[model samples]
Target: MHKPLLTTDFLDRARRHYADEEAVLAVDGTRYTYAELGERADRFSAALQARGIEKGDRVAVLDPNTHYHLEAAYGAMQVGAVHTPLNYRLTPDDFSYMLSDAGVDAIYADAEYAANVEAIRDEVPTETFLTNDADAVEGDWESFDAALDDADPDAYERPEMDEDEVITINYTSGTTGDPKGVCRTHRAETLHAYLISIHQEITDDDVYLWTLPMFHVNGWGHIYAITGAGARHVCTRGVDVAETFDRIRGEDISYFCAAPTVLNMLGDHHAEHGGATTGDNDVRVATAGAAPPEATIRTVEEEFGWELKHVYGATETGPLITTSDAKRHFDEGADDRFAVKKTQGIGYLGTEVRVVDEDGEDVAADGETIGEIVVRGNQVMDRYWNKPEATEEAFSERLEGYYHMGDLAVVDEDGFVSIQDRKKDIIISGGENISSIELEDTLFEHDVVSDVAVIPAPDERWGETPKAFVVPESGDPDDAGATPEELKAFVRDRVADYKTPGEVEFVAELPTTATGKIQKYELREREWDEEDRMVGEG
Candidate 1:
């Protein structure tokens, strides 16, 4: 006999085997056992049922990295409702568009962010509003704990679900247009969780810190993977460098995921205030969102004494189809190891990652031939929600069945993929292709640069030239230790002359998304606002 491979199986298994074990450490220091967590989820399911939420209805969750997000997500999935997570950093207008687009029936927004939802409550189709702290919110939102307390845990029924049923909808960042909901099935999520469990090396004794947003692809599927493994979830409000170190040493955190920017924050903090970055537990950190500079990876591995696993994927994919944890490739020298780890290593067990040209043919594996990265696997999204045209365009871009990642990359002979830049972020100057990632990576090596974003600035002579916005280490642009000409000469000595930034401006900080990825499009918009059309565009 075969199982249906539903996402609910994860929590069910944990409840059956590890019910008495500590399941989650809430942000406020409250600890809940698996049995307690499971009951809370069951109560949430009952409450949703009582509130007229049915199977297939969309239930949105808006919260930081907290236990409530896990409970709300599992509760909705337990009763066969679609779990739709919203980015807490989004504006009220963004929430309005997503909630209205998804036709969300009910929503659980954290008290801090519920006001955004409340601001647009009149425009959405949602009826039930729930918040973790109703007293702090300004609307008629019910307290989540109160709902669970009043609910009869056994009153809800679990509907029969198929493996192919779309159980979750994740929204893209909408940098180009309106955010599209990426539809994923039970089988897709279940398989993705399994893959991460294998690659991330999660175990029952591991303590996972929630530094990454739980809304990001369901914490990159760790919400299910960690729970299914019967591990511990140490919740947090967000990434606070000092608080993160305290948690690592206090709770003995074994594994966690963070964007490269968060890692940089930790590195910077360690440099300023020297202290123990790890405790008795051996730490492993998974980083993505961008290819971290080799310097960042070296700092993480050498100074912090932590294992760094660089992963790559998108919201449309499992958000984790590839990992750089291939130990077999690390048998070479230390420099070779960092070189291998710097690239997005081989695909997961069942994932097929390839670099293909415009015609869908495989690009040469010479490590210099650039092409688009496409993938096909069990964890890829089925389609976009309510947007058939966008769905068709995504899957049929350069290849038919594979999901286009929209990142241009090169593949090595050993199959390691190195992302050069986003398709639109590539700088075209004097008919030469310049990768902004390459330029930024070069700049990151300078002592005075804390962070950098390179964009195509319009030029009368070259059509468009590379311009870098640098965040100084001093946190004050005016006090930046290095001058623009000095930084320009620094890059000129490191890379090709054409790849060097023609102009450099110091900034106090760079704009980042909720997940800590740099918003390069904002920089591009500012640079090309006066131009009729961007260079190299049709």
Candidate 2:
């Protein structure tokens, strides 16, 4: 007989089968078994119900990666409430907008970030506020710890669940305008978590490190996936080089996921500290957001001896659809393996990833033809929360049933996909198309360039020309040595003359989202603020 697939099954299975297993190593150095964690989640759920949080209510949780974040999600979903996680990096105004937009009825915030919510408490529509540390916030609010401590775990009844019902309303990282909530069904999240386990080789033997934030797509759905697999989760408040290295050695961490920037930091730290000190521990890293350069991949594999796997997706597509695991037949040597790791490999097992032209025809696998990436799978989000127009646009009729990724990519003969640039970040100059990612990758090869963002600047001759905002590797970022002419020569020698940036503006850093994705839209807005059209007319 078949049964419904609810997220609670993950927690229930763990509590029943892996009750004695260590489930969470909290950021504060506390450990809890699966049974204990399940009980805590149950108590939190009971407490929410006691506070009048009925089924279908929208509850928001704001915190960094912590045990509290995990519990909040599990607890909120347990009682049939839709969980909405707030990005801690955002401002109070952003929080106010999101709380109001999602119609969040209740909030559970970590003590450290309670102040952010407190700042706009009066303006927000939420009636209930629970802080992890009640003393940390001003005014009256429920204490998360106290509520759970006082509640009975077995006192409440779980509502009958429909697997296809929306359980989470994850908001997009609003780089341009207000963020939109992507309503995800319980079925989608469960399937995504299962796919993560299958692709990442997650097993009970694996120990996971919390380098990725739990708020970002529920830590890319690792919270449930890791628990379902009975793996140990080492929670961390933040990413610290020293602490991360310590956990790798101390906790025997075998797996983690991070953006390329974090991986680069780890690589730099290892090199500075006389190379990786993990001894014989076999650590594997999954990186995304931006593809690491070929050199970075080589150093990560050769110097650190840790396997690097690259995966790609967005918040709408289960946030995971492609993985770049090195295949034995395709990899003949270290160099070949590094090259393979740089490309965002084929679709995951049950995912359908396609690159199509404007006409909705599949592009040739020549690796040169650029097309938009579209996805259709079990994990793809059903729709945006209360935004039918946007949902229709996202799942455009041009592709019939697939969701448009808004990312332009090229697929190789072997079906490996490499991203060119976001649809809006592409530069058009004098009837020529230029990929900003291509320029950024080339600039990354320069010894003195640290970070760079390429945008289209208004030009009388070329309609629009490429302009670079650069962060140098040494001295003052505004130093004249990071000269426009010098950087122009650097690009001219490597790529076509048209691809060379016309001007270089040095800055301390590029504007980025909390996830370390460069906000090219901000730069483009500034450059074309005065133009009749913000984006290139071409």
Candidate 3:
């Protein structure tokens, strides 16, 4: 029989499971025993309580992945406080909007980022402030360690949490349009964590390199699973390719989850300087987002001996609903292997995924057909905060119960899901839903371009035109540049003339979110300010 599922219950069980085991290992050679972790978490709970934080009160944290940050998260969870982790890299203006929207009452931040929140603290609801480094804190922020220093290392009595109660109010950075708050429940988080622990094979024996930020779907729901499974967590604040390599070797890290970009960075780093293959140091990389290009997937596996596990999900879907891990799919011919790897994979145990056409009828799973992918499961968000109309439209009377993911995709007969084109981000020039990603992917084949973000620029005749933001790779090490004409000519020769960017802007970097997703909305704002229509929305 299934037992009672509870957040604190998982904590208790994990504590027993890994009693003598080291539950966390930091990059700087620090370790926290499972028993010690429980104490630190409890101390954090007391610290928050002393600061007047109460159950269900929203506590916002703005810190990168660190051991203390993990303690703060579990502490907030223990008190039933809603954990709202903010991206520290966000400007004061962004913090202002998010803090006001979430009604955050208390905050914890790192030394590097305390100032951003400090600039807007007076205007925000945040009262108690804790910055890990006191000397770096400004605007009445106090020391973080001070609170926990004097507090007793005792377990906080966990409040009764219903399955549907909101545990996290994760804010999307709004890469396309207005940012929406995703309210994930205890049940959804627990189950998704359970899915990762089981599917990813996380256990006490496993040591995790905390590469992904905790703010992102709770580190793609690995924080809970890693902690729930009593696995060791090695903390670090940045993702330096060299540092990542050293930490993997230094921490003896066995498992890590990374975006396709990170995998690409590692692959490039390895190409520049040789590294290990087929050893404990040869880690398993769980890649998501943009489905690591076929070449990327192959290179990572063959060169580094990385066990590449491809999976896909969104912020609203509790992040780990589909994975390409079915054994039969991989056991086929080489063409079939590549074909299976291309899909977003199959649904998790309790998750249901469907591809529906324009009329909402289920689409064929021939792998060639494309349709919008919608999901119905325990992992679905409760609703978009303060946006009932969008929420209603997202859930259908036809599915009768499913949540509609705005993504368009297709599936193979073997049940692997493949993302096609985004419903929006589709460029319309003379009435064609031109895929900007397709054009951008094609343009990436050019050697001159280091990185690119494709956006729809305003046009008088066609309503929109493709615009390219190109960053030239530093070739000379001292010289910085890419001529717009060079970028334009490079893309023109490869793609259709119309798809070639009407305007090319040379920049050092394109703006991106914490998760490394290109902030297309920022680019769209500059492109569509004068236009009557919005470029990002369909």
lDDT tens string, model 2, 1-538?
A: 9678788888888888899999999987899999999999999999999989978999999988888888988999999999899777666776888999888999998888888789898998899999887886897889989999999999877999999999998887532344679889999999999999999989988889999888778888998899998888999987887789889888888999877667667767887886344634598889876566666677767777778889988888889999888475365454667666777789998999999999999999999998999999999998988889888988985588899988788999888888765675656554334667777888989888888888888765455678988888864676645578888999887766777999988888888999999988788778767753443421
| Residues 394-463, model 1: lDDT tens digits | 8889999899888888999889998765665666554344667777888999999999998888765455
Q: Poorest 10 consecutive residues of model 1 by lDDT?
A: 529-538
Q: In angstroms, how far off is 148's CA in candidate 1?
A: 0.7
How does candidate 3 score on lDDT?
0.75
RMSD value for candidate 3: 10.5
TM-score of each: 0.81, 0.81, 0.79
Write down the TM-score for model 2. Answer: 0.81
Residues 90-150 of candidate 3: C-alpha lDDT, one tens digit per residue: 5676688888888898888888888878887789888888888888765677787788887
Model 2 misplacement above 4 A: 174-176, 426-538
lDDT of each: 0.88, 0.82, 0.75
Clashes of 2: 0
lDDT of 3 at 309: 79
